[model samples]
Target chain A: MEKVMAFTGDEIAAEAMRQINPDVLAAYPITPQTETVQKFSEFVAEGRVSTDMIRVESEHSAMSACVGAAAAGARAMTATSANGLALMWEIIYIAASYRLPIVMPVVNRALSGPINIHCDHSDSMGARDSGWIQLYSENCQEVYDNLIQALPIGEDRNVLLPVMVCFDGFIISHGTEGVAVLEDKVARNFIGEFKNIHSLLDIDNPVTYGPLDLFDYYFEHKRQQVEAMEKAPEVVKKVGKQFGELTGRFYGLLEDYHLQDADLVVIAAGSTAGTVKATVDELREEGVRAGLLKIRTFRPFPQKEIIQKLSKAKAVAVMDRSASFGAIGGPIFLEVRSALFEEQKKPLVISYIYGLGGRDTGINQIKQVYHDLAKAAQSGKVSQLVNYLGVRE
Target chain B: MKLKGWKDIPWGGLILEAGNAQKYETGGWRTFRPIWHEDKCKQCLFCWIYCPDGSVIVEDKKVKGFYYEHCKGCGICAQECPFEAITMEEESKFRKDQGGRP
Candidate 1:
């Protein structure tokens, strides 16, 4: 019923796109993300899919065209990384405000200033508040699976907002892994056809989009967007459960590995979660109670769940791959710390900024993090609340 | 129609029709009204071409009259008239002069 084959993350994303066969795809090439569109373009050339691939001149125009296509009652999709996502910033907000269910696969890379094209969370984290549902993948298998599930979650009548599927730039985007390719018919049947509630092309109904709204109604429309986001978590869970029925793989807002009865835990996201899992296994064999909490959904942040999971731990360390310049801790660290504030039994939490600009985060560095967590647990206090792991002091 | 609250307003507050703007009688906003003169009129149609609100009524290649319902009385037609055929007058004075028919 399913075929198992080795494929890169980019190829898996392309395969998902071919299976979805969206009505429109408008994208530009950026490192690590280029292969995704490149492979999709071959699908277009060879007549494997009927998607109208628009080779736009810039990322801004690519997102603009996606908004237009989605407004015109078509299922639109795109892919980008780093600066490409930065260039589409204005239209990104516009797309979400218009409430178009456009899906985008963002190959995560460091935002440029010092000009780095390496794996990091800066790009998507920069857009955390832009009213789009964000799903992070830990490996190639999850990347493919997330992209397929993104459709129903975003296109749901109650949650008509844009969705972004994020994976590490080079680590997961280029890394090859064995993936179970779902049958095209099964994917299609599960996703179903996109039906727009309000379409620009609906001649009889005649509606308008993206009009000027002053103080009288602007706040209400924004509140409506908020309500849609509030409704997303349930829709995402429902869709994930249904997808699990088809593929036998279940997903949740966060994945807990060896967390029960563990005294020290590490919270991380993306491909780094795999390394953390391996290190957790080793720590457990050595009789150390090290655990991991892997974040899967970042946008509609699982705040309550995060607090519940980390509240009883002796000490918690949040590993962030991106920096927040002047902030005391990184983005995820800030969120985790804030969430824990509501809990009476708050654990001693520390922030670790690591693997920025595509620096390798080996198992040794991860073991060091566990060692730090163990020390923090014993001391019941952290000497350095904010730390830079695997970086030159 | 009376708008009760923001919730009653459609999303984005978008107007659905192409020229449905005519539904709003902008004539109420008129401070100065345009008065057309037919005596020294050349009917060159420049006024019709330059009217921003599309309030200049034209039919069969001839200027019919101002569609006052949608006109904001911007005086664009009066400014664009070549033969001094139209003039801007205070709405109060014009209403008194024409007995409120002009």
Candidate 2:
């Protein structure tokens, strides 16, 4: 084990980029996400890594340039947040649909109508259908770790899909936390070199990419993207286990804590999961049967792992940082409901949307959620599909 | 590993159909057909200079036109023509025979 000084979340993410040392790193900065690129630029300027760090005009061109670079068989990376990510929406879909295998870090934030530079899952959740493999981080360590793990999982021979490693904007992205820095040689060996099977601009092969496929072939391409996304969980687990062996930190599809002996559990992803874990500790100290299931990977949804982990719990409180707007409930809760609906004894799953626009989510709100879960278990009924925490009307 | 006749196939294992070269016959449509109104002709070749896709061709003192098989109908020449001598009339009769713009 290598010991280094405690580093901030942004510094750890930058070190991972330094280790990966992608051939192409293109980005236009938005708040919270700017630090990753800044440190990356410093690394490039100092000759620590030989990377083409493109200072693109907008997030659109940043992603567009990355798409071209990846198609040219270069190991590519980029970063953005909130509106920056929203601006890259079109090309993000293009990168995934074409299976370009680019890696991106999204400092997750709320999409603006009122303009917020705060933590939320809105940016990443809005891009769910874009076919990118999405991984959410619960802490600074996970942010550093997920970027290292995302490389091979994304660029796997069978997968060949783009990946987005999301950490909460301002909450995790800007918030400083202690993280153990791994050796460059170790990280490089862990991720290995990128091998592009089908690059667009390979002159020696001279194959045309992103052609007008019309209906006859477009559906098959989309179907293949779906199939590739399905293949990611196994790849993620395989890569995660390999990482654990190398670093002694185990990551899985869904990380369960104190759930084995508890009857009520709270589910959350991103930075808020840390608060939920803290809340679980308090609940257990009070002799309440409460636990937490922190989701690490959102796409490839981790349906089976979620079902198995929550099957024994009497009730579940799903905390979502983003709203699905209509129909059933919160995005995470809707997925959880669908996963549990077919089980013989389904728990009373309730959805709660909290911590929107960087509103500070303390242990009290999490404690309140656990209280609701316990009440639901006692009453044997779910009061509502979705509830907003900390909102006064 | 050297499979004959498969070298030209695109990846995702697409089988290139035969007679793909004839698809290049649309090269005839690359140039624009300028209608010369000998009465309204100021003979300014600004249309030839400003065309980005280079659809116009100027020869000698007289402006001889060609068929715009690949003309995309951008009408840049029509926009740039100083004399209003060039009109972007579609190949109505030929298009009527070939369904639409070939």
Docking class of 1: acceptable
Per-prediction TM-score to the true structure, in the order listed: 0.90, 0.83
Please report how far candidate 1 places residue A383 from its true position, in Å.
1.6
Best prediction by DockQ = 1
Please provide, for model 1 over A1-393, each residue's C-alpha lDDT reduced to its tens digit, 9 standing for 90 to 100. Answer: 779889888999999999999999999999989999999999999999999999999999999999999988999999999999999999999999888989999999999879998999999999998999999999999998999999999999889889999999989999999998889998888889998867899988787788666665688878878888888989988999998888899987889999998899999999999999999989889999989999998888888889888867999989999999999999999999988886778889999999998999988999898898889889887989999998897
Return the clash pairs for model 2, or none: B29-B68, B29-B69, B29-B70, B30-B70
The candidate scoring highest on lDDT is 1
What are the runs in model 2 whose C-alpha is more than 4 Å off? B1-102
Chain A TM-score of prediction number 1: 0.99
